[model samples]
Target: MDMSWPHQSQPLPRRRALAAATGLAAGILLPTRTSRAAASGPTQASALNAAASYANPVIWQDFADIDVIRVGTTYYASASTMHYSPGAPVLRSYDLVNWEIAGHSVPVLDFGAKYDLNGARGYVRGIWASSLAYRPSNRTFYWLGQIDFARTYVYTATAVEGPWNRLTTISTPYYDAGLLVDSDDTLYVAYGNTTISVAQLSPDGRSQVRTQQVFTAPPSVGTLEGSRFYKINGQYYIFLTRPANGQYILKSSGGPFGPYTMRQVLLDLRGPIPGGGVPHQGGLVQTPSGAWYYMAFVDAYPGGRMPVLAPVSWSPDGWPVVQLVNGTWGSSYPSPAVPVPPRPVTPMTGVDTFDGTTLKPRWEWNHNPDNTKWSVGNGLTLRTATVTNDLYWARDTLTHRVQGPTSTATVQLDHSAMRDGDRAGLALLRDSSAWIGLERDGGVTRVVMVDGLTMDGNWNTTGTGTEVASAPVSGGRVWLRATADIRPGAARPGTFSYSTDGTTFTRLGPVFSMGNDWRFFMGYRFALFNHATQALGGAVRITRFELSVP
Candidate 1:
């Protein structure tokens, strides 16, 4: 039986007494049932196990470079955009478990002239990693990040989700700007590369007024950056992770523009640099309850780097240290006091039988989509309007955002007639640089692969298998499925299978593996595309898209 509850998905109304009563009833009710069940044996948390796991990413998906901050009663978390369009969409939570989109600070990014960020797949056109800082002196929330040619810039507002102020360009070559506001309300920023520098921001919080000064970095720490400053125990502390190593902590008597001294290597990866691996950037924050915590990005598998959080302790000498036992962070921690239910590990569920009234949030646009290419009313139909290779349909093709590996997506395609140059296919596209698609040529369908901006022949050079067959679409209803089984340190493998009806499927035998984590920055995306060709028959229709993971 398919469980489709549209009413259950809507947000509840706000009422003080009613909410209080509901909370009290929920607190008394659920645990009682769970306790009774526990007496039998260890029981399932809820009916929606996949949703619970997806909700708590630490328990399921691989989350990376997490920057989190508490604003008012809400906690907002944002991660590094591996390279998709609208940059990184910030996820918001009241406690940390139940999360929602908190609105993007960098909504409209101008990469430069000519190359609009609209799906131009190259180096860094969209938002990269960003730092979220709350400045009370001006009552402003600041988002600092790096875009393609624009370099490092800061967008400030009084709200977390904002009609943000214009970009405050910091002319420095620093990549990631870690923002901090001291006890005296002095604003400061830190960046790492060949040199680590700390500078004081002007009172308006728009520009840096003080001279940039060098901060303490161990002679052994090579090109370490992503530095952040926090005051603890009457001493200002600098917490930074070596991009090529583990994390380090330093202390200074002065403020951000400080004569700081290196304290200790809080956490260290085994072996030397360059060839030897180290965990990437991380974020550190103190909870309201006075517990010190550290959250860092870890690449557990070669191509599967995500975020993990660990607790930190202060040594007798006032140096901070990360606790690790057999060489891994603790697996579980208590959720915040606010009762956010654990989410299912799998998010996109059920058959998205596209009767076409609403478009799912799981579907994403390439860079920024043009509103004209798609319409939803009956079955969701994508109209091929633009022909220019430089147009919006080409630039902002429909794609899926990267969640994690071990997931599957199935979409129903209807392509009876297609133009000669115009092609429609189910594509697993990382960017224009790397993509693999199942395309139909004449009466035959072939699986093709592209690596770093260049498309190979019918087969992949890196051992990806291939298959050719007669075009499967005879009457209408054609189902294509893509499954990704990604292991972190190794190559992520994906397969494309097809079926005439929705039931049984035949393996097309096209296998492709994206490189391991830390080697390149990219996101996994699934898109149904129809490119314009001179041939008159190049148009396709999508009835529905269903995605699930086992």
Candidate 2:
């Protein structure tokens, strides 16, 4: 018995409301951005219990423009990370509700020079709306996406935690393309905006065999994109998102590219978050026992777009539907079939002692990093990678996604070695960045909070950052913390605090407002940086970074 309903124009039932309210009590509705580990709904033990239900936006964090697939008993999802290096984040899960960082397809943003942050920036131009597919016969996974709308790049790996190799590039861009490795192993891609097209690829999925325009959406459906390909029960289905509000399906019964028929699959505004955007633009996956689910994202920025899972049912004629409760999308659902494998630990939150040879998959650089400038052994040491007046252009600035609704990130670093004109600290990085850290000048160190940095349409730093607060400090090691209030439609401020002695902390500067504009794309990220304003050679040793839900 699958308990599900289609969208109808009616109010939610009291019982559904009661269930959501109950979960909010346990999860506490979060606060703002943490790191990534802030769990929602319930504890993992209870969350994975056979009878326990899970909430929508199943795994909260900026896993936007996601495409998911199942391999054996495990599920993996890849999402957009515009401009952030080690792009195309891949998240893995067993139960779908418990997700963890599972490496990235692009170890570094190697598309061009700007991605290196050498002298220019690629803030809103990197891997996004990518396609992920697995060819079980070959024990390989394929990842493809268009960059800056110029051309599509292809990558392949034997394992999810990969040494992914860039296979080749297609001269023509397959915008928001969806890859389908058909039953015969022939490759096809369904892509484009408003006017949708399908292209067949060579055996290895590197070049195109042929391409054709398949279906063009009506003007009333809004702009269509985020096309995902699936062949269900013999029908070749192309699922697309109107992105701002709804989802639709194009079905071709005879061939991969054909005269197809389209239908409205989902058009609803109600979701888990109050005043949040509709669920749109994510992929679907199936369970071993044959249950189907649609994984979509709801726009809840400045926290960034987060993924949600919804049950799907097939119509007698074979169209797919997104389940609803009391005429609208439900906030929670009965747990999908639980996996037999052990649950994976959550990523990003808690203490990162920097005690390993490599940073966890959750960490990404502000752009392509200068590998020679950083090292990790006992503690993460960052050498000033560039000489710049602004942090935006500095190389090797590492960032982690800011957790949603509400969260906090704290850093403890040894700044004794910081040379003159060196600045090292923690920041909520966005178009309008704000941070608190140690700034060294003339061999003297002081804690400072800087904001008021301005950027133009081109993402250039039009105005230099201003120091809002400063304090002389006497310590070899200092702790800096940033708490963000990124709940959509709220105050959305990022606050800062500092502690010289590891025991106590005091507020440093006035709350700084974070941005929610789409041009900036990637949401507020917690950044750990050590950059030089005059010359290189200075460095900072970060011993601990603790992120938590407050």
Candidate 3:
């Protein structure tokens, strides 16, 4: 039963009304650091320094496949949120080093039954690479995204924090798509895998007028995707990322349709740096002062692919060159020169009380959530449902991006309502996942740590599961935690633990290794799920959730 509705004509306005109605009027403004960092522990303040220069991996969390655009003095970024409802997160920043979630382009991804968590499922597929473009011609913002196995869509919003208008779908599948509106008001889309492509959109912006292969990567360049297109100073620039190399820029002095020359503009092929990985897939942004910077991500595993900022300047040959220090990516640089008022620095991961009427913008559902199955009123109550035997197929799992190299997430669960055959706990979710939770079996409650592996990319139960540890428990309340140590050159295993008293924890399972599979496309995330293996099961209440870096 898909019960999702089309976004109302005026979503931002309606959202304001809903916020006021729900007593969230005070939270409508840009998030303040004092309020957001109150419960985030000591690491919150230490993450950023009060100096003119900032460190590399500007955003130390998994903000993968980043696409950025500058609007006057403000910088707006849109990133891929595959299968995470309230998809295509839009982040805003005054200084490039700091960012906060402003809003999402879509309230829900209800394109098909799978996206709605119905009989079918969309795991590694939903909204892939998205391109965010602002056209000064009509004062409109366009967001184009590729929905796997479905047609591409272009969403329009007058304001970035939008009541976006859902436009008609483009019948072509544009993988790693990028949207650009030329000064002449001609709409063009660039995308491809091994072969880079460019297409002209119809005047109405609803269909493609013509498509062509602009450039193809040679066999030497392995795994090329994530195309970000731009037309700057009368030159058409297309950026592509290859795991074998770093990021390359293709420049065409001709037009949107091009006879382009390619150059390796940004490369960190020397492998992982102290706080960053190889620089890859991202967009170029310019400040009001006319300074240019490249925002990209590195494959950081358990923490996923995190964003990094690098300074950019053009060479004598008219090619953009990334400013690397001493033949390597710099660890820190002077912050972007932008004049703005003092704003709070917010951490990517924080503490949740589950007392508000709405979940924080940082939290997202694994899939389009069943609104009727969860609530934040009396703590976060997650009602169990028998969707499938495989946890990846389970719906309504709440998740947050896992923070870098080292971080720990803890959740206090009240399982008084859990029925027999129900499993409820905290998990590190990806193609391969593991959880430490309370399972109800034959009227006996036990604390169990289970590891599940998906053999192929499919969402079938053919995958194997191993019970690492189990112990009988008598209480209706339990505290569970998982710690990840994924620092480059360090042992990469996620350890799970449980506690009867919130003060002290007992190690539960064998250390589980974190994995990276291209099929998933994103890094591992911390997730909360409650599901039944057999029949309709019980509910679990998450009283408190906290994430911290050790």
In terms of lDDT, the best-performing candidate is 2
TM-score of each: 0.73, 0.91, 0.85
Using TM-score as the yardstick, the better of models 2 and 3 is 2
Worst 10 residues of 2 by lDDT: 28-37
Instruction: Quote model 2's TM-score.
Output: 0.91
lDDT (CA) for every model shown?
Answer: 0.52, 0.81, 0.75
- Over the stretch 150-254, how does candidate 1's per-residue lDDT look in tens digits? 556777767655667655787664456577777677877776653667777787766767647566455776556666666655566666666655677667766
Please give, for residues 196-259, the per-residue lDDT of candidate 2 as tens digits: 9999998877798899999988977868999999876667889899977898889988889877
Candidate 1: where are CA atoms >4 Å away? 1-63, 97-101, 113-121, 124-126, 136-140, 148-150, 157-167, 266-280, 300-304, 333-394, 414-420, 431-470, 489-491, 533-543
Clashes of each: 29, 7, 0
Model 2 ranges with Cα > 4 A deviation: 1-50
Sorted on TM-score, highest at the top, how do the candidates line up?
A: 2, 3, 1
| Positional deviation of residue 474's Cα in model 3 after best superposition, in angstroms | 3.6
